[model samples]
Target: MEKSRVYFTDMRTTENSNLQKKLARLIRKAGIGNIDFEKKYVAIKIHFGEPGNLSYLRPNYAKTVADTVKDLDGKPFLTDCNTLYVGGRKNALDHIDTAYLNGFSPFSTGCHVIIADGLKGTDEVLVPVSGGKYVKEAKIGRAVMDADVFISLTHFKGHEITGFGGALKNIGMGCGSRAGKMEMHSAGKPYVIQEQCVGCRVCAKSCAHDAISFTDKKANINHSLCAGCGRCIGVCHRDAIKPADDESFDILNQKVAEYTKAVVDKRPCFHISLVVDVSPQCDCHSGNDAAIVPDVGMFASFDPVALDVACADAVNAQPPIQNSQLKEHWNESGDHFHKVGPNTNWKVGIAHAVELGIGTTEYELIRV
Candidate 1:
């Protein structure tokens, strides 16, 4: 198989060129303009950092991408589905508010922020995966599937569960509707934290299967009846409901790739990953840890799999930052993500994606 082309550009800039301008140049050189953006609805998938996490990509990067799409006559919107976990972004309204709080407002990004899933996280479109093993029909956010083109703007960083959160994680896990997220993350249903549950019956009201029951002013979920739609998790006011994080990390990675395939299939797709921040855990965390390594650079590729591999390789080649998480967990493995997050194998997702014909792991890095 031929190597996929992945483009790179450093963070350094001249007086006339800032990071945002360099980002614009990188994507164009990577072939973003090859897609017919004229009059199309383009979904620029992104993670608007959790309320307190400072490691997510800034909106200025997103603005450069959005502006480029607009210049090509495309209608662009920044989007991400509701997270399965209970947080500031578990539902559309709170998610949008959080996006705005994190500087993803229309004014900042030159595009509106859309919570791909609707208000309660139940608005979804079942998208079939052509060569899926873990996910046959992925439940994607309706708005994401509704887009004519898909672009992933990822913040490449270490992830506790998946080793790293790169393009595949951004597209697959980020695009899934709440139920879809539940499926990838666990085989079991969400259980309420009784101490945190105020017995407001809010969760019970959101359950489509009537799976939640209250006793002694505490909520409990009937796993047998629960479809794991994850609506209750979104509606909880006290952050009482918790999605089960029981899936083995390998399975989680493979499922993430399958979900990504569901998202980008049949769409004109492009991907860009910013390797700045280099945090030791997911941006989903309300707090970010110190960088595991120095910032690498920005990467772009038409092939998501190749983009991810290129980013991971670049990170692994860097020396771990002193006293950072990577140095703390230094191992003989020589893989930075695995050293930081030993239990997970990030390669599982990349290998599975290649098997599913997502893209080749082999890549040629083109410095832009």
Candidate 2:
């Protein structure tokens, strides 16, 4: 396979070109101009940080991308799907509010914020992909599927499940609607923990298929009717709903890869990974720990797999931060993320993505 070109720019600034300008230049150098942007709906997928997480990508970077898209005559909007977990972004209302609070407003980024899924996180489009391990089809957010072009503006950071969250993680897990996320994270079986059920009927009301019902002063999930969308779990204030335990880590990784393919299958997609925070866990966590390593840099590519591989290599090259998670398990030349997340093999997602023909791991790092 030919080496994929992954463009990189360090945190260096000259009088004429600031970091933002450098970011734009890197994007162009990575081939953003290859796609026809005229009159197209470009979905700039990003994680608007959870309310208390301070390590998320800044809105300033998003504005740079949005402004560049506008210059090329494209209509750009910052987007992310509702999360399946109980949090501030479980529903569109709270999700939008969180984005606004995190400074992702139109005034800040020159782009509207759209929760990829609809109001309740049930608005989805099922996309079919053959030969997937767990999911033959991925239930993706409607807005994400409807977009004419896709761009992943990802905050490259460590993830407890995937080892590292980058372009693939952003599109696969990040773009999934609430139900889609459930399918990706676990097998399609959810149950109610009777002890945790408060009989509030929130889960019952939120379930689209009437799979949940209150009985004997507790909520029960009818697995037969439940599509395992995970909305019920998020709506339960008591944390009563839980997914089945049979879902293995490998299955989750494969499902994530399939879902990512569903997202970028037919689109002209560009990927940008900002490896700054280097957090020990995903940005989905309510709080970010101290960075495990010094900020590496920003990476961009048309190939997500190559981009992710390149970014991971860059992070591995940096010396571990003192007193951070990576330092605790420090092996001079070992994979720091894998040590932190022992149960997960982060390479599985990227490998599967390559096998699914999304992109390649072979890459040449081009310093901008």
Q: Estimate each model's TM-score.
A: 0.94, 0.94
lDDT of 1 at 285: 93
Model 2, global lDDT:
0.88
Off by over 4 Å in 1: 200-210, 214-218, 331-333
TM-score of 1: 0.94
> In model 1, where is the ten-residue run with the lowest total lDDT?
228-237
lDDT of each model, Cα atoms only? 0.91, 0.88
The sequence of per-residue lDDT tens digits that candidate 2 reaches over residues 64-168 is 999999988999999999876678898889999999999999999999999988887778898997657678878899999999999999999999888888898
Report residue 299 deviation for candidate 2 (angstroms): 0.8
Model 2 clashing residue pairs (backbone): none
